[model samples]
Target: MQQRTFEDFKFNKQILNAIEEAGYTIPTPIQQKAIPPILAGQDVMGIAQTGTGKTAAFVLPLLMNLKYAQGEDARALILSPTRELAMQIEENIRQFAKYTDLRAVVLYGGLGPKTQIAELEKGVDIIVASPGRFLDLYLAGNIVTKSLKVLVMDEADKMMDMGFISKLHRILEVVPRKRQNLLFSATMSELVHKISGDFLAFPTIVEVSEQATPAQTVTQTLYYVPNLKTKINLLQHLLKDDETLLRLIIFCKTKTVADNVFSFLERKYGAENIRVIHANKGQNTRINSINAFKEGTIRILVATDVAARGLDVSNVSHVINFDVPIVIEDYVHRIGRTGRASQTGDAITFCNPAEEYYIRKIEKLIRQQIPVLDIPGEVFIEKTGFEERQAIAREIDAQKRKDNPDFSGAFHEKKMANQRTNKPQHGGKRYIGKQKPVRKKR
Candidate 1:
């Protein structure tokens, strides 16, 4: 059989013209194999990770099918795990449908319901939404699912990790039973397999690669920092010396840790040089931060595991794992963000004694030994627990305080004096009566 180009697929002129305008001359392997079956109206099980062009693979076929039959309600529904990813998918649809009149709207949280409701009222042919926000609007009678022709669960594994299986079931109950179902995931866990069994009907299963495999283009290395202070020092040194790094993403395990790392780096380096984004940030702020990072306006982006799911920043020079992820597969996704679209990149992880167990599990999952770099003049030992970690954090905080002299003491004194000055005179009543009596005596 001869290989087919994107033009070989019989699509509407509008979609083909848009594809050409977007400069996608050739289809990816996954797209070539899956688009035909999808257009033929079959349930698809697509297993691929971020930066794999999975969005276009599904979006193009969906556009072709929906363009044939215009509907007032959303003909296709894409459910992603994160707001960022859902928005990205919606943007992709817009770009692919630029010449066409197919309307698409994004449904996400961290924004007012009125805007989303207004968009839905205006009527959208395709709706891309996160699971949580989708349910909220669906329950409120803001969206109609009875007209849904194609139901897609993008990033199903991430949804399972976020405990959205119940929500998925609820959505499934509401969406029509005889609709095309497509489930896409980076990897297939037991939960994803269960979803497959329940939702799909002997579907054309497509596994592009092994579930836990990281991209071959990524050169992964590990460095044992031994302590939090040493980790900071090493990161600073790495950033200073590496001129090849155009943009860097440093991943922390929690929001507090992410903030701490961002603050530490901001103080060490200039605050203008770094951007921090996580689930805690507002939607617009997060989007702006990510856009800045993408456009090379920001050099470093410190994020939590929330970014590990669906962020598709390209040409990322380095992916630094400040803290090893507890879920082993996340390591794969975190590093996978760097080496994208066949571009060679690097993934560096800082593992301390406390995180050695997690590191070992990650290595086992990826089935490769991440070359460990021993920190010079450092000793490794068993972890001393959270108490020791907090002591270290306090020590680092103290060092920061010492290095940058705190003028807060002076400010504190001034604030106290201002408070004293603003206090009422020491009298039960105003002193105006005493002043008048004194003037009269004078």
Candidate 2:
């Protein structure tokens, strides 16, 4: 079958012109399926990974529905898990809706609500907001939700992962129940499904791809480094070849580690070459850093998972996973940052022993093996410290226990060994190894 174009969709001339202006001619699979249902005033459940034009899949139709601004209360409410995503959606709306009189405002936490309240007072046709901030404003009487006509939950799985289920429910309660519902996610978990069940009514399910599959444009590789220090050494070695790894994002599992990596990179590559963002960073600082990285002013970006979902920077030459994501499905999203829009990109993952379990799960999710490469001889591999070794062992044990509720951990095995040798195994007496003791027993 021939592919569909943006003009083929039920879009007004204004939307079509905006699409042409944005240089978007072909509609992606998610867009092709989702736009019709959305425009027809039906609930839609879209399962698609990042970099698949999922944002536009929903945003375009929404822009068409709200052709012009009418009232102080928002007609559509788009809930994103992160402020970055909220901002991104708002930006996309502004761009597509620029030809019309529609107005949009993005609301998120981590900043005072005074400015957001002021924006709401000015009136907006659409509201893109994180759940918490939206709830806060709605409860505070700063937001009038009686006019809401459409509800969308972008990155629903992420919201569930971030423990925003209750907040999602609260937002749902405040919004008009008779409105059309839409939920989009890279991977749909049971929790996300539950929320969708409550959120969508006889929805059209549009799945661009199955769960946890990374982008085909991304070439993935894995390095089993011994510890954090060696991972750094490998990173330094790779970044040394600035040509191939021109624009890179280093994903860390924790904020402290991200900061540490940023500091190390800053020391070696100069502070101007890198910027880091995590939950602790100020909202403006995060936004500025992301903008800098996107503009190629920064050669590297070190970040935790919060930045992983919201980042839409294109032409990222490589994505280096400095640490395996604690959220296994995020492995797909992390690598997705690099390979986008028919561009070839490298996704290199550094895994320590403790992270082996997650790496295995990641491989299963992506349905492909990450080619393992030997660490370069020039990079010195440091031995794991006593504390780090213990930490790794404990983490592995916890992972095992999570998989198997009755799993006996390494520490448990040692305890059992002691019980077998140092104490009685059963309710019986300990056996003697000597032949004399055997004859007495006979």
Candidate 3:
């Protein structure tokens, strides 16, 4: 069978030239399925995993719809969960609309909106923005949603996870009632379904992959490290083979872990070769780090989940989960950083005893078990420290209790024993005083 190409999309000459210049000849599954519906002015609900060219699926059709720049107010609005994703969509628009005069302005927080407002005043055909910033500007009269012909929510599942439903509603209320709506998400949760019902009218449902599943291009592996130190040590061992682990991303669950991993790697690999990014870092700093990693100037990038979405660096060789993600859905997004654009890559996860709980849930969510490998003999497995051990124990107990309602953990038993010892000598209360004692709330 002959493979379908971009030429079949019937895009205008400007867009075709731009697509050719971008070196994209073949349409991804999502693009092939979702583009026609969107171009036909129908509501579209696209459910595809990350790194499946979802951006182009929506962006290309929107570019075709907009045609060229005309109005002083924006005609299309694309809302993303994070500034990184919004900027990424903006770049995609620029790439596909290079030969045309269509204007796209990206609006995000973590910085003053003066520049963004200035751009909006100059007239834009498309606006890519984070939900909070989008609402803020719209409420402040900088954004004119009356002229909006299309509304798109990229990473719709993420937006719901980040508690953007109310803001989404607000944005929806302000936009024209008859505009085309397009919703895309890697996974469709109940919240996403509810929003889709509210957003789309007779929508074309397009799902290219299984929900919460990574691409086939990625090979996954697991290591049962004892604790943080051993995970770091295993990372060191992995990085020793620089040829295989050329460009790597280390995803930690928190900013602290990301900083710790970055500092350790910087000590050994030097700051010039490693960069870290998280919410604590300034916006400019995070953007610079992402750019550096994408340019291959840095061999390793340590990041939190903030970098998990819309990081379109194509040549990432490997992704190491320094810590298992508490949000199981993020596991899909984290590993997705690699194996993008149909390139083969590796995803290695380091799971300690406590984190093993979350890893189990992640396995169930993804419907697959990661193949575990024994720790290498050359890599020293340090003894778990007392504090870390206690913390792990507490976490495991909590997880067990969460699963079983009747589960009385050791702490519960100890508390019951302590209360028994402190109880009245007799079953009856205040026998000596022959009076009822007032009881306090526990």
Q: What is the lDDT of residue 173 in candidate 2?
A: 84
Displacement of residue 426 (Cα, Å) in model 2 is 23
TM-scores, all models, native as reference: 0.84, 0.93, 0.93
Worst 10-residue lDDT window, candidate 1:
429-438
lDDT of each: 0.83, 0.89, 0.91
lDDT digits (tens) for residues 78-185 of candidate 3: 999999999899999999999999999999999999999999999999999999998899889888788999999999989998999999998888999989999999
Better of 1 and 2 by TM-score: 2
Cα TM-score of candidate 1: 0.84
Candidate 2's displacement at residue 144, Å, is: 1.1
What are the C-alpha RMSDs, in order, of all predicted structures? 14.4, 4.5, 5.1
lDDT of 1 by residue, 63-166 (tens): 98988436668888999988888878988998998887899989988898999999898888999998889899999999988889899999888889899999
- Residue pairs clashing, model 1: none
